[model samples]
Target: MGPGNRPLDLEWLEDFLALAESGNFSRAAQARNIAQPAFSRHIRALEEWVGVDLFDRSAHPAALTAAGRRFQPLLEETLAQLESARIKARAAHDQAAASLLFAATHVLSLTFFPQWLGGLESQLRLGPIQTISDSFHACEDLALQRRVQFVLCHGHPEVPGRLDEAEFPMLRLSDDVLLPVSAPLAGGGGAMHSLDAAEAAVPVLAYSEPSGLGRIMRARMRQVFGEGSSVPTLPQGVDIVFTAHHAALLKAMALEGRGVAWLPRSLIAAELKSGALVAAASAEWNVPVEIRLYRQRADMAPAAEALWTLVQERPPGSGGR
Candidate 1:
């Protein structure tokens, strides 16, 4: 069958628009952050799919042919209509689903969510759960987009979450501490590194920007070490040797004796009990945080509302371990 008979790709249409706007293949490709060859292929594929010559190849800056000019308005309108339909469909699907969607940071998704969900199951029979485990930044994005019913992450009232308090209601679920820790020395003598030590630099395994714990750590460090403290920055007494998005990965690195890491105490409880990890700094340096759940201002699925209500009814210091 000819290209005209096949399904059209919206991406190609977008490419066509980009190429038309830029007036040069190389410029459009650069703007789109795609290789020039790939951009040319997209344009060619678009033309082939439409079975129309959209651009004048001989023109110095790639002027559009008659067919191209005529197709532009129709393509624009079609794309807009398609986008509107997609948004409406997604909203309807979200409204119709009985289950709750949660976006949780990786560490909490592993350590806290299962236990919390188990506890809630006895109180309320949740229909089905859809949880996305990701970095705090990604979870925030999901919550902001209203793609998920809830966002669960470590929140420090001192350092606000990405979602504005006015737009998203928050419930403090539990209290957790960010503990500065490192692997015990050989033969389990002592911690491999200490923040208190007057060493040249304390090698550290740090978290990437996307991590909630990383944000908390950076905020706390700034408060403790003054404004000079920032992630991977050369603070007066510390040096960040490595950076990662996952707290579990940083904990693993700390266990390997690579460097000190500030890990959630809940996550490394087993390791701490086994004498594999030790506090790298005093209690004074530890950052206190809350395990919080955030929801949009708008109403959610009934199951999600019930879950939220159940959580709110819990007395202070009841749910957290």
Candidate 2:
């Protein structure tokens, strides 16, 4: 006999099970779409391998031997399991192709994801996908409702715990950089050098609601500027002042110098590199945030798996500004 612990050859096991069910070599051969002689040879091989007589050839209409009778249930169970496995494999290959939904905060979504996704889309060969852009809270609601496969957003209290419930990990998807920026000064003089020393009236534009970056900025402001000195609403002192969607827009306003804008480094890399924009602060304590991705814990479908792999394959060190 073959090594007792060796895994069964499924194809041979299946042929044996079919032959047992049909009870005739010719009929079993027809069911399997093979020649009768070939079927007989296969069964003989199986019997020799198992070291047992499976059929009583001398009997009319072919009957199972005592050993065959004892093996019947196990053989039938194995066939049934094989059938179930085939169905599941087919589903994963076809019917279970993943439909995808992704949401991101405005800044990261607007600034870098287009390029990242352009790279990702080239790899996906299957399934429908939808990407939503909205406030961080909206992403949360969609993720909670199972409307989206993943959410991309900045820091939030719900974080990894929220993803854990769905059996997904919160991956640090990108490194983002934040900077204070302003348009070229009128006399070609550089803009504000210090948040305090600069004209206090220079309106700092910020989000109207408590948002992911909004909360971070609000807390940091209080800690740094003393209590009750937060910059008031959008365009507070002038109509041209700062504010808008993610940091991309925030950085855009900074380019015009309506007021100082805090924005991601990736958002302004082009301008910064070309000398069109300037970094706001050099202090490491001045900026901290990251872009993140979330996925479900259940068996990931092909499309989701494809996207997940593409997202992970990005070169590391892309900042969460």
Candidate 3:
């Protein structure tokens, strides 16, 4: 016994099963790519470890002893389970190695992230990406808490928020504009109910207070229309009738002719093209916004750093739709 036999190696167990299946020491050794003497030694080691003879050598094609027959199934199952564990462990390790996590606002996650990521994949060696799609506030929290490597959201130059671009480095990724749009009038032909309609009738579909686009729009509205005449208050004096956090939900309501909504051009481009939605306000009311990515100043995982570098190299609007 090697070193007075602390324990038998897993190879000895495998050798024992191979011999049981092949029914010949020489054949088992050949199948295992080892010499007969080594194979016999492995079998002897396993038998010694188990404290019993495992095979009847007197048989022409060696047959299993009663103990070996019982041990055969047990060893086969143990090896299978260990192999499975090995695969899962390697998979987990690879995921940890390549993972780059991101947090994004709901609208961008749906409309922009996929296309933007696809373009990067065409040029870079991106591994795995995990994106958490949430409300703007939630996404900001994830970034500030260091739970995610990057935060992707819509940004306006003048608007201020929790994540100061000064503290967290930012990369402008693309350009988009906010359009105040409404559903086409019931009879159609590309006409829409006006945002400047009767005070009582001008139902306003609005983003909730915590929305990122809403934050931008609020600031821009005050600058464009003056404090008293912003989006919440029409020139004729009507407040928002419906409010929600998601742009998609607001779009749905607007499509049903419920009210006017300030939506992203990227989000409602199809509707605008098809005459399903029309501008609710004039050019002065439109807000120019940038698609921005922000990352902590601290160094992140190598995969995340590589992704950040790739994004920084691309010109704004490089692969945008």
User: What digit string (tens of lDDT, one per residue) describes model 1 on residues 1-321?
Assistant: 249467776778888999889889999999888899999988988888878789998998999999999999999999999999999999877655738899999999999888888888889989878899999999999988888889989889888876855559988888888888988888877799877663568888888889888887777787333475533333346677999999999999998999889898889999999999999877877778899889878988789999999999986446546
How do these models rank on lDDT, best leading? 1, 3, 2
* Candidate 3 deviant stretches above 4 angstroms: 1-98, 189-191, 197-201, 223-233
- Per-candidate TM-score against the hidden true structure: 0.70, 0.55, 0.67
Off by over 4 Å in 1: 1-95, 223-236
Query: Candidate 1's error at 317, in angstroms?
Result: 4.3
Clashes of 1: 0
| CA-lDDT, candidates in order | 0.84, 0.65, 0.83
| Model 3 residue 194 distance off true place after TM-score fit, in angstroms | 1.2
Candidate 3 Cα deviation (angstroms), residue 138: 0.4
Q: Compared with the true structure, what per-residue lDDT tens digits does model 3 show for residues 173-198? A: 99999888888877775436565554
